[model samples]
Target chain A: MLKNLLMALFVVMQGAAFAEIAVIVHPSQGAAISQDDISRVFMGRSGDIAGETFIPVNLADSHPAKAHFDQAVLGRSSSQIKAYWSRLVFTGKGTPPKEVGSDSEVLTLVAKNPNIIGYVPLSMVDDSVRVVATF
Target chain B: MQCTKFVWVPALFVASTVSAVDFQYGGFLTVGAGTIIDKKESAYDYEGFNCPCFISDFNTAGLYERGDIGWKQDTRLGLQGTVRFQPGLSLTAQGVARGSDSSVNLEWLYLSYDLTNEITLQVGRKRIPLYYYSDFQDVGLAYIWARPTQALYGWEASNYNGASVRYATFSGHWEIQASAFAGNETVRKSGFARIYDEVNQDIRWRNILGADLEVTRDWFTARVVYLQSDNSITDKPDSADFSRPADKQRVFGLALNADFNDWLILSEFNTNTRKSRDEELSIPAPAMSVGVGRRIGAWTPFINYARFWEKSKDADYENERFIDLSATLRYDITSSSAFKFQINRFSDRSEFQFVGATTLLSANYNLVF
Candidate 1:
């Protein structure tokens, strides 16, 4: 029984380590978006992209994809991200992105809003949203 | 002040009943304890407090006395709520319950409107933007130190009734934020005054005008600020030594900070000048703090040095000088909380031994929810 449990844990860790994050936007968003733009938007440094205000959405912190996205795109750990936002939030300087529960919820929200941007595991990408970048 | 405790309750209830309003509430907590581990043989007398004492928090008059472990010096709870009436307009209110005074004080009540995507206008009560961390100093979780170095953060008044305009935008590879503010503040029974005198003293900063600019690129950040105001003091018991007429005061400050993943550096310098109308008394006080830290996984160890010195042209005026050296270790308990332990060595170099010399050991658990 212990061997089986160990095998299952190793498989889960391998899956998490190899998973890729895909940045997504509404299909209606036609303008070219760069990685820098996505980084700025997610960091609350800027909201403008291609002369339009872009709203960034986030997956809940509990989601594995959230950790993957944070490490791959923002180059920050979950603790660092929380600390960064705490400075902005307590000072009333900025607010973090709105959060949704899962990849499906993120896709649904992005599909309904032309300006909303989000991220999910590459395997969860669907026809409702366009994948802008993958890492 | 009894009504202050229930102020947010009504606002929360109103927001809940209004279908169009979006309400969000959060809070921060710090449970801190400290003691004077070592001290000079002679007591340093200053009004109500004496030797073997360390002022852990100068703004709130938080002091750790002789031998007993004190939790009231740094413990506090703060709540903040934002009621968004619309996409561009919102109201924010914050209140803090302090362990030192055992009182709930309303700290911020401001109305903010987005004039443009890059510009914001705010009106009402807000923290005096005197330093980089002044706005969020009460939220201990936001900073790596157990407390801001007292050599610089100690002040007469912390908040003001003010109006300010803030602008934020990206310039090439730099992220820039700038603001200009003007207001006035009056503090009753000022904590800063209590350090020197036993009487209840009132202090006022009138026509307070200030501006600041901050720019960041990658791992580096720089900030500069300038402020000027008319300051005056009045003693409740009519003490001749404490009361001063309106004097012109100006302050200039700068900060340079860098965070390169594993390595971090934080530094700040400030100079303040107060001149009397007759030009007989001119006091210039300069203070600086430098801190460096290295992050290894969830543990970060830091060391810091801070100093405050006052130089007066008049030889008769006694100069006040002090230095603080601290070492701290912080452990991230989770994303929303942290545990920190710090040791401080405070040395009094003043002509009169203003606050005495002592070594302190302190710890805190900080969290935001």
Candidate 2:
């Protein structure tokens, strides 16, 4: 029984292995994105990146992938983010990243806007939205 | 007042007209009704006492409908706007009714500038930032509770008109913010006081000052805050009462929040006091409380317990302790709106004291732009 439980735990741990949030852009767009720049983009703390401007888009709050990105990337929850932006919003300091719907939808939108950067499941990666940086 | 109302129109219309400006303005009006059985004590006719703090005075001024049997839901319509002008500069403004009772009052207004790569500054009228929820005390989007602990931020000087600066990731996964402010030091005035001021004098107040700090990491966020306020008086229209001195009050607070995958943990505490040195005149009362909140799927159910104990030094303190148990439920109606409802039961114990235990139920829809 102990060995079986250990095996089950191992499976669960494997399922929860580290993952990355792929900051994606239109495949045709010519923008070099570094990993650190991607984190700054989604967090909305970035002022300027490269010569071209950056527009960060977020998955809808209710989307499951959003939770994954928050845990695997931003390392927080929707409530924490809301509390965070509340401090910013109430004081006129920071604006949260704009939210879009679905992984595929984010891919489509980012694929169309040169300035746009969004995150999606690795499975959805295609020429439509170029993976700028993974994680 | 008309000018005050107009300033919002052009601003609202400007964003509304913008074809696509990450701006979406929304809010809701709710009607809540419920009955509560006092688990503690009963009411008293203290309104007729010699001290004479009128029923309307300690009544519900700038407060919700007792959140009990009446329209306890502080139904309100609010507007919030976000404008992005440059990479490091943005502006946001929010305003809401103090309650179903107060006339329109400005809630928040500020302009922010991100200086350097890690520091940001804001100037204008804003929440005092004295608690985790101070910045969004009345805004309903940040949590699962109908309201954060009143003990955590119930002081009269919890809001302010001034400036604040924030340093985020100055070193690592931590951020710190501080603010200083001054605003009208208005007190809990009775009807008689209002009458005296309207008929005999001007309604002016002294400047108040305060500040707060917050830091966060991968899985945790913490905060501490303090505020001091000068006292004001409602002098008699006809009397030899040379009585109008500054009343000094200080409030200190702390809160911690942690999240792990599907589980969450949160706790907050506060202590507030009012008095003058020499014991000239003093509320001399200090109060504090703690609470916990969690989330589950699309529906996040939460429970919180709080206690309010007023010192006996001042007659008003009453040596009374207030205990409250509350539950809240939330469901997302759309990507941009949510429906929330809450139920709270209150208990108060102190011989001959006012403010007793009551039960209240309320609900509202929250939307944003």
Give the TM-scores of the predictions, in the order they appear: 0.92, 0.71
Q: What is the lDDT of residue A111 in candidate 2?
A: 73
Alpha-carbon interface RMSD for all candidates, in angstroms: 8.0, 8.8
Candidate 1 C-alpha error for residue A74, in Å: 1.2
lDDT tens digits, residues B73-103, model 1?
Answer: 8999998888878777899999999898667
lDDT of 2: 0.56
Candidate 1 CAPRI classification by DockQ: acceptable
B-chain TM-score, every candidate? 0.92, 0.73
In model 1 chain A, which range of ten residues has the least summed lDDT?
A98-107
Displacement of the residue B89 alpha carbon in candidate 2, Å: 5.3
Flag regions of model 1 displaced more than 4 Å: A1-11, B1-19, B39-41, B239-244
Candidate 2: tens digits of C-alpha lDDT, residues B1-369: 001222232342243335432343333233233334333334442333211111111112323223134343344556666564554566666766544335565666666778866777767766666667666656566565655655444543444566667666534435454545556533333322332233332222346566666676556777777766665454555743324565566777777777663566777777666675555545534444444455555566767777666664665434646666778787655434567777776665544565555566667665543
* Cα deviation of B222, candidate 1, in Å: 0.5
